[model samples]
Target: MMISSWRRRRAARRAGKEPRRNENGEMELTIPRDFRCPISLDLMKDPVTLSTGITYDRESIEKWIEAGNFTCPLTNQVLRSLEPIPNHTIRKRIQDWCVENRSFGIERIPTPRVPVSSTEVLEILSKIDVAFKKEDGEGCRELVVKVKSLAKESERNKRCIVTNGAGSVLSEAFQAFSKASFDVNVAVLEEILSALTIMFPLDGEAKGFLGSVSAMHCLKWFLSSGDLSRRRNAVLVLKELGQEKMDELSEMEGAIEALFKLIKDPICPTATKASLTVIYYMITSTSTNEQLIAEFVNLGIVSLLLETLVDSERGLCEKALGVLDGICNSEEGRQMACNNALSMPVLVKKILRVSNLATELSLSILWKLCKNEKSEDGGVLVEALQVGAFQKLLLLLQLGCVDKTKEKVSELLKLLNLHRNKVECVDPMDFKDLKRSF
Candidate 1:
């Protein structure tokens, strides 16, 4: 208790200005304005000065440059180079202040590492190329690990590694390994893939190699590999491939099944989301292909989608519903959805609960099911009401939706209302009509 009192008194003395007490009777320490980064408005740990004479945290400025803006964030001056010089003076001052304020829980920031350069990344890539040519598996692995280490150091390092053509080099190495009948050590293959994962949103040159048949083989193998991280990276790469190359994915044998397997037995949250995105792409791309849609239905994708919707959070829920909506574009998909007992309940539960897009998707899928209400049982309509779909629809209307969504909601209400009276109701007692048995 005495030590605490001493620390408080010390803090008060160090307060350049008069320290003010808060409602809780604790002194509020103010950070100096110059110690804060202009862009982030937080205490600058690694301050760097731009050519415009404005200083910012290195991470913040690097992100700004990575976003493709070459001008100074504060002064709007055009940048001749993206690099920023470290403001050693400000950093040292901040460190000293942090040391003096240790009793107040402020931590001294460590000196920042020298930022990696594209030239350094290129040199490493060149060494990797030499290692590959010599079929030196161990040498290749070590170099790839080094590159991965650099990529993990900072976002700037990653951009440097990517722009210097690391992706293309690593991709070519993977192809070479695969073409050699897997002659390269598995360790080498793993390291190459690890390095490539760090260089994400693969550049056009890298993507060209990945789109090849050999790269497809490599991806398929990794998707089924025992390593969960490898599986995650494989799906992420596939997601990055986008809808344009979905045809290649469809053509790859068991590729669709393998993706479904990933969803069924998720490797991780990121991997699961990626797999769902890939499936959504595939479904949309094959919208008109009845055979393919039928294949998806046969694989029980509709039931799986409904299952996924039950416990998913907003983003994953949105993607799952999107895939289901595309699946409903086919007759078989609609029948399967209606046949599943969980479909209406899950879809109804998501309404107005997740996000605008999710509500829209649930409504779209429900509309597809109810659009053909003339079926033998009218079960879809009856079941929708049974699941309290009527009340949710009414609430959604009251909440106000877009014109497109409002139209669907109106049509759904109309269809559901038709089956309203058809729902079994309890007989209310009428005293006048009641006959007493005495």
Candidate 2:
């Protein structure tokens, strides 16, 4: 019987099947009952690196010591720790394997979502609206958080609430709040502007229109707020609004003052542009010209307008010329404007370098000065004429599709003819030929 059993065992060993033990009297592979590590709840940190000279963190080492399984996860052999393996290295290897296998169709865990009901959406919108209407700042803040949450969940709904409810609601609320108290209104205005900026590119039609209306309302409110800082901010906002609204705003008293103030302020370029718009409106509106021109002089605004001709902004320089047109239409106003402008040589050079529109404006202004019976330096026109300004005017007349340009040139020609010997007269035909070509 013993011989038979020995023969069977030898036969099993010879069949290429292991006796499940190595020379060291240890199992070749020992699978742990639990695959998770106590500390990390992940696969064993640094598998005991027996031959690899790798080490692991204390928790991993302790786990291997307790499990009595010091084999590497990869090699599945008895580990020999030659040196400690860094936790980072172990993590890197695991992460790299995860990435590599992921491309091969590994199962991925999905991120959890927070569910929001339709009622919650409506309620949040309502709350935001109410907060905005009542000027309840704290309520508005709370609603903003809820709105942000909704936005994160659904961009469509996020845009709806922020744009329609939050954006417009906040703007109106701030306007009302500003009306109640200047300081509070200013604060609310600042906050509302900030909210609008944040909610830009609002999604739907309702939101888009609301944003436009809100922006316009904010601009109007700032202009009407009567606060200097608010007016300054209004100037900036109106500038951003572009020429369309600016043209509409020119009719308002607050807008007029705000624009004039901007022109007068040494620091803001916006004033130069705004002043030009105001001046344009004032000149074109025949009824408002006298009053507007008087206001310009009263406010000491003429000097600044003249000064802007030298400003780097070409648009502003042209606008200044337009303002000069209005100023020079009246006798006292005309003299005042010419004296103010010609006093600044740099301004004169700027005007000379300007476009044909600007040159025509300068010519009209010079013509006014030449015709002024009260001009302190009536000789300025003669001096201007000496520089061939009259010839330039006549040249401009050749290009005369502009009725105003032609009329001004005709009047200037008449003045030169009337003052023949006093001023050197140039033939109108010379300019007429130049005009044909120009």
Candidate 3:
């Protein structure tokens, strides 16, 4: 039996599944008695009991039902009822055991938050509507906190609320505040924005519904002036709602500045990511809009993005470079990027430092600048030479980059050597190092 168990664990590891371990750092491959699902022979994540009193993991039994099976897996006896009650007691026991055995590499399972019921959601919505109608600022703020809590409970609750018309309700409430002739409490409005944050993973109809509201203009207000958490969630909502209305957002005063503010000084990592995502979608959809590109340049997006690249997370760096790649296609964007003091080294460093996506974007930005030599500064070639870009490019060529990136590097190298005399900033030792390395 030990030999069979060892073989089972060996096969499991070879197949890329993690085998359980003991406190002694050896594989403790034996399955716990109660933790195992009879149908799947795996530890149960969400256990449930059948009408016949047989228990199985929810996913496995659900699959069994989906496959048209009506009998209990253990008993093979027909179940009088198809609905399986969640065996919360067994699930808690499993969690407790995991906590006790955590030294064996067991992760304690977090208790799943219960999904919000449609009845409760409706009650909250009814209160919000009543609050809005009465022009009750404090009441609206109080009720919004409840809505926010429900949405934050779980992904399931988020989807449930949005599906049950919570998106439209939240949006209309914001519109009501914005259009009110009396003094609208900014705190109340911020709460409304917070509620939207919870409902942000909205469906297309929810997105479109939110997009139609005049409240989007409030993003410029909250993202620029609200607390940190509000700013983060505001941009997140923009990523979804702004998609349908990029042009409107671009035209809206302070909206563009608010976005740049987050990108430049990012309230948090998620805020930075949302800001990049917003810019990426904005540029990709309007690639040919010279006016939009000009706006991006005037807003100092290129220089700001380069500065943002210094130590950003890989995903943010990838997206920052991606936006730079698109915007650099414009003359104004190229000029701004090449003019920035830190642009060259940051771009060069990101070439191989970040992921393949970041590398591709960095190379593409370089290609665009190199292609546009008519600018008085002679494109990115001048900046690249000033930054000792040859050293990195040579290493890239020797070490290897993607085929397209390699081609861009090769073309960039020739430009560097061709413009060598014009490069007042080139280090003589760099050439000696280049020659010796070659």
Candidate 4:
């Protein structure tokens, strides 16, 4: 009986070692379960064992931890430490398997570079501070460039840099450099801003420093810089600084004009939205400041805004409408808006057609245009009726909007009703006549 059992065990081991093949007769190698990261469920490239004894790919685990979870992904075990230990044994096995199965089209996973540690980030920040304090522009430039590279490397590196006081240090350097002669320190300042941009959502201390007069000065300079990337970074940082400082931000030389330029010719979607957001905040902050609104109009904001409302996506259209609402408070803005052939028609078309916010803002602009005695030429109201505003407004009221919006819609209905005889209220289904009018 013992001899028979031994023979059976030997045969089972041999069977396990035999090459696997499908009906097509091609060799197949099933990856061992241990070779896969528990988190990604794929073959581990840079397997690192957690404190919970489970292993995961470095990239996947880092992202998981960055999202604020501190437990192991598989076991749900509380982690003793966030740092993952390298599982060299499993990695070596994976690499060997790749080599053995090279004929099966399996490629080896290249070893990943070590993630930048918080200590290393802090050291770099220290060097940046030293160079900045010494006024060593060349050294500071080099250090900031290194920091920027690390920031771009991975999200892990960004969190590490932000975890240390990199933002505060960089903001300090930016403010200090901005106070100096522009020609001498522009290069270093640009590098610092680039690094700062990567590690965004500036910490509280960083936000305070960047919101200062000097930092705003530096940002204003970058807004008009020839480098598109720097301009984008500057606008993003300006957004992070918030609108509490809009009074100061609007006063910066060429700041509003540069922002208008960015809106006119967007750098990227994010930058364009940031520019629009900043403009929205400025307008909201000074809702009663007619002079500022007219200044924005003089910058050709009205025509640009109308173009945006006509062509932009929903979010951009909403923001554009918000700014337009603020501007139309003044006689000059309402006049420009009414003068443009597309203004009243576009405003009427946007009602009930876009988001609730868009609907509200569009209605607000129309209300301002139609209700203001200074600009109520009846012609604007006639144009709105021609574009089917009456039916859309009725639909908006029935669908129910916020109380404020409901009030505006009702008032708009009343105003449009007054001009019922001038133009027909066409339904959306009445396409032939609508097309003919166009």
Candidate 5:
């Protein structure tokens, strides 16, 4: 009886001690230890029983596997598959755990609320348009801030709102800003311009809307205003809208005329750059008919552009090359471009150096010159050939072969070869001598 009593006491002691199980299966789990889930890096949410009869949070196990930390907590063996953990089972376990763990009161997280709806966004944009029309600087600012806030919530809706609203807002802003002679007015207008620039690039629809309306208004404002600083600012803004918008700029009766006048005004280099940029955009974006080319020729814009090209400013030269390319695209355009002595030398030099826009433009100009053989002046084609322009053309063809410009380069090469042959045939000895001189 004493030995039996001693055995019972020993069994009680063993039960009180922490148990560890081996292959023999003689152990007991008392207090469950907290397990970390690899996915959330938090305490395990859903305790699951695996096929191996091991219990774990399915999410935690899957996360561990996903993170490449696939070792089981108890066995220290890599998990073969996490796919066996049913999502619904894991969710139910998590729900039960959350319900039982009342130690921490459930705190609801407040989701961020989107303050603006589609209709509200449109309404706000309409207000901005009205504010701009009335020259209400304070109102415009308020609406702009509101619109921006709404845009942050729903980008697509905000873009739609702005696209429809740009024209009215731009026109009003220009009118109001132009009429104000005060510094305060200038400050307000600057803000409006700044706001427009920010809002216009939301997406394609927004850009198209601004392009069709705000661009024209901007051009008009610059033309009507004598304030050099304001004109300069307007030009800067127009240039920033990019070359694509230039095609959309409506050629109202006075727009191009005003630009020409600004170009003639030598006092403002800033305005000149702006005007050149505008002309460059026009040339690149639109088709130049005979009448329009004639108008540009008569205005002496070509000579002005040539002068700008020779100026120390690299940007101006780039713009002029773009313009020259436009002019040389047609038969009449080629004659107009080549008629001036200053035009040829500068164009030749630009071609030789491979200036920014020069290669494509030079190829274009050469093509036109070759097409209309009578249009070829004394030394224009020969000078181009002598200056190693053909070699440059060849190089462009080789490089552009891998890019979208390949087809253009190929056509240009064909045109250059034709012109090279003409020059060779006309004065073979002269061409050879010129080549040697170079």
Candidate 6:
């Protein structure tokens, strides 16, 4: 408590423009306006000034640009140059102030690393080429580490690395590793993949070059064998490189397996989301392919969707349900849905739990399951009755639903009651218009 209080007083002194008193009644020094970034209102680390004549921390301004903002954040003026030149003079001054205030207990910050230039990234790429040509994995690993460090430093550095030919160079290394039968040391492969993950925003051309059967082999190695961090990075980079190659994922080994594991037991939400996105694309693209649908069911992808629906947030649940809806169009998929005990209850529960998209998708899955085969024995409808799905569907109708949704609900209600007595709770008076619709 005492140390925190002392630090609080020191912080107040750092920013105390009017020299306010602390809890102990000690007056603090006032910070000058010049020491602060105009946007963040804090001490600038690697301050860079825009063409609009306002200085900001490099990160703040870079993010603003990356988010698609074309104007200056503070001035709102159209920026003549999105590129911000470094304000080295101000950084030096802040360093000097910190040194002079040693008695005030404010620590001095070290010089910030300079952001990389495209020319320098190109030079590194050239070195990577020479090292790889000579089969110098050690030299290649060193240069990769260097490139990853630069990319991690800032958005500017990332753009520099990708725009210049470094992204392709990294992909080529992975391709070579795959051709070598994964003989490269695990550490070397990791460094190569880590560098590729950092050098992101691979354009269409770059993605096209990297999207190959060999590249899929490299990604599969990482997904199946690499450590957790490398696995996540592999997924992220795969998400980028897979943009133009979504269809081929179904044929790729470890693609569905790794993605299913991530969705079922996620290392992180980001990986799960990436996995879902890739799966969603693959499923939507190949819903009619018997082999792929069989693959999904065989890999427990449908059961995983049920589990995902139980806890996923609105957007992710919507996606999971969308994939579920698509695959349920296949006979094997519907059989899998009926096989999993939770699939029925969970699919019914998703109605009105998340969103309108979720509701429609859930209804579609149920509709697929009820057609001729599964509903013939009245098993799925009985499962619905046990899970209170009967009540939920009527409540959905009572609360009023869209025409198509109401149509499906009425049809399912008829099917549910077909083999048994009229469900006592769902009053005919409540569904007068529903009666007319059927």
- TM-scores for all candidates: the values are 0.80, 0.49, 0.69, 0.87, 0.47, 0.74
* Candidate structures ordered by TM-score, highest first: 4, 1, 6, 3, 2, 5
TM-score, cand. 4 vs. native: 0.87
Model 5 TM: 0.47
What lDDT score belongs to each candidate, Candidate 1 first?
Answer: 0.82, 0.54, 0.75, 0.82, 0.56, 0.76
After aligning candidate 4 to the native by TM-score, how far in Å is the CA of 203 from where it should be?
Answer: 2.4
List model 3 lDDT by residue over 160-232, tens digit each.
6776788777777776776664245777877887788766566666565456546666765676764788788
TM-score of decoy 6: 0.74
| Model 3 regions lying over 4 Å from their true place | 1-47, 50-52, 56-115, 122-141, 154-165, 185-188, 281-299, 374-417, 420-438
**Local error of candidate 2 at residue 290 (angstroms):** 2.7
Between which residue pairs do clashes occur in model 5?
Answer: 48-56
lDDT of 2 by residue, 1-438 (tens): 999998887665553222347799765422121323444545453432335444343455544555666666435666565233344444555445444446444333222233344466577767766876776766666665655556666444454455344555544554455455544445555545444444544334323333354445556666556565566555444544343343345455565665566666633555456546645665556465676667667777667766656555677777777776777787657657656634324333443355767776676666676666443434555555544555555555555547766776787767654444555644444333232433
lDDT of 6 by residue, 121-202 (tens): 8899999888776777888899999988888876677787878878788777766655554565556677887777766777
**Quick one: how many clashes does candidate 3 have?**
0
Query: What shift in Å separates residue 376 of candidate 1 from its native position after superposition?
Result: 3.3
**Cα lDDT for residue 53, candidate 2:** 49
| Deviation of model 1 at 75, angstroms | 8.1
Q: Show where candidate 6 strays beyond 4 Å.
A: 1-30, 49-56, 60-83, 95-110, 133-135, 163-165, 184-188, 226-233, 243-249, 252-266, 314-316, 372-377, 394-410, 413-438
Which candidate would rank higher by lDDT, 3 or 5? 3
Error of 4 at 371 (Å): 1.8
- Runs of candidate 5 exceeding 4 Å displacement: 1-191, 194-219, 239-250, 262-274, 284-289, 311-314, 352-357, 375-379, 385-438
Q: lDDT at 141 for candidate 4?
A: 93
User: Which should have the higher TM-score, number 2 or number 6?
Assistant: 6
What's the distance in Å from true for residue 126, model 6? 3.4
Which is the winner by TM-score between candidate 4 and candidate 6? Answer: 4
